[model samples]
Target: MDTPQNTALMRALAEVPGPLPTSGVVHISLPHTERFTVVGNHLAQNAALSTTAVGFAVRIQSLPQGTEVGIKALAARFPEGEKLIAAALRELEAHGYLHRTRVRLPNGRMVTRTVFCNHPEALLRPRPADASKRGPALVAAPVSTQAPAPVTAPVSAQAPALVAAPVAPHVPAPASVPAHVPAPAPVTPHAPLPAPEALETPAPPPVTDRPVPAGPLPPAPPAPRLVPPPTAPKAPPRPLPQPRELTPGLQQTAVALLSDLRRHAPELVLSEADIERLAPATATWLERDAHPDTIRQALTTDLPQPVKYPAKFVRHRLTVLLPPPLPGTEELAPARPRTVVIPLQTCEGCERAFRSRTPSLCRDCRTACEQPAA
Candidate 1:
């Protein structure tokens, strides 16, 4: 009979399904039976037991609502079947993949229910495999792990022992060597030769036709004489002052005053009003303080006399005026009209008004006709 431990081991082996072959393994593109098995197994080991009545669960919280399979169907496909299914459900509950809620049954009794939960990580992880058994390949086992050999000693320590020692000198027999030999005397260097006596040298020959010595340079030409410049001529003395004649107007006034005095000796005094009226309009011209009588007389007498004039009538011309615009005239000026020149042409077909300069109809008609021909 098989031992209980051996049977249990066999059961464990059976429970542990072999990893999918590399070629046979299906990529977990979407959730299916194979993917569900792997996920369910992982969740069963990770989740708490009491969360779900089942021992294991494939917490597919990210799975959309109204999915086809239930816990029973998912568990049936896995190796451990119902046991793994219970575990998977518990794992899914623990990981928050599925939520548990209390609901009233049709019979009026309240019961705990399981539903898929929403989580970003659970949705992104590999999905359960389909019934086709397609998923990614399983990981391979590790290779051997043997220990390495010990390291040996360095060459420096062993070099001295491997080397040989030096040998002593050997002496030959007398019969093989020379009989009587004189000992060599000590060597000494000879004295150096005596130096020659010093001799007197003759003086150099005199140079011919060389210029005579400059004879003290003739006393340096009596450094140039520094004569003083000629003095400037003195200016002539100025002339003495001379008297000047008076202006005619002043002379006339003086004569009139003297005549008045002579004619009326007893009443020589003039009225203040008459004297003020006779005064010149410009006071600067008669100002004795600024210009003395003598300087004034000299200036007035030297100046050219003024000409006397009599008043007379003269004619003046009038300037001409331009005429004003007439009433009801137009406000804006008319614009100039533009002139355009048209080129003359001879058409290949009609040859009437068409001009050949631009080849308008000939080129266009040819292009249009060529398309149909092509």
Candidate 2:
């Protein structure tokens, strides 16, 4: 802020007391509140008042609600006005002088509305359970068929009918010339009723498929129930990986692997994120029981010089080269024999009741049976 450019600009610019040029002579009206705010508030008296942010804040405060606060509009007032307004707005917000709220309209869209405060005590973060949150003070109530009290104006017997009176019957000229009676002035429609009373006015029954009711509508059908949608069963979450213990050997391997990748493609600037994301790929390769040398060779063999987006390329290559997960020791162990052995059977021919490997008879008996009986 104390730079030479700022000092030179300050020196170069001088205030000339005069009215701003418009299409013609013009004037702006301000209430006592706004005039006091401009003159007495921090916007005009603070340390930042020399900066464009203060001026921008003053302008924002001076304008009434619904005024266009776009960058273009602000640029018309301050030099480099758009950027100035943006900075000023941020400053105002940071200083608790401005904040915004999101309001969903009936059309099912959300919009941000800037809430500026000349004497704001708005906080940056609001508590979750606070009773007051951003919304309109009033919400709309549903319409019902129960009729509102009908407004009745006093009826005069001599009052004219709502419809235009029929044109006076033309009379054949009794005399050669007669004075023509001036036609009555046409009546303009009356102004509409105020909106609050308009809603309160009684409406006629809606036309429908059913004939006009002779009696009352069979107590109008009960209001439709708002049934909640059926929920779908949730899928089981994937298991998270267990933390890896970095032994000296494994750490060396990881470092070497990283070193080899960097050597192959030096263009990539590795970060902790790249390391973390790529760690899984390396772990997968190791879990598949791949040799460190093989991994290095696969990466270095087909690598094109000067890889573009090297981190991603390396990630894809590592994933492509990932070996399947290794089987656990339990899966690969031999099936154990039963502890209790069955008694052996003997051959019927030899009167040996040995437990036979062959079904229904001993091996010798089966062999003998298989041979031709002689």
Highest lDDT model number: 2
Relative to the true structure, how large is the alpha-carbon lDDT of every model? 0.40, 0.59
Residue 66 displacement (Å), model 1 = 3.1
Provide the lowest-lDDT 10-residue window in model 1: 310-319
State every prediction's TM-score relative to the real structure. Answer: 0.17, 0.26
Candidate 2: misplaced stretches above 4 Å? 1-37, 48-50, 70-83, 121-374
lDDT of 2 at 196: 46
Top candidate on TM-score is: 2
lDDT of 1 by residue, 87-192 (tens): 6555555555556567999999996665653332444444334313544545443322433222232335544473232332576646643557755565332433
Task: Report how far off residue 284 is in candidate 1 (Å).
Answer: 99
What shift in Å separates residue 197 of candidate 2 from its native position after superposition?
48
Off by over 4 Å in 1: 1-64, 67-73, 77-79, 106-111, 118-374
TM-score of 1: 0.17
**Model 2, residue pairs in steric clash:** 344-354, 344-355, 345-353, 345-354, 345-355, 346-352, 346-353, 346-354, 347-352
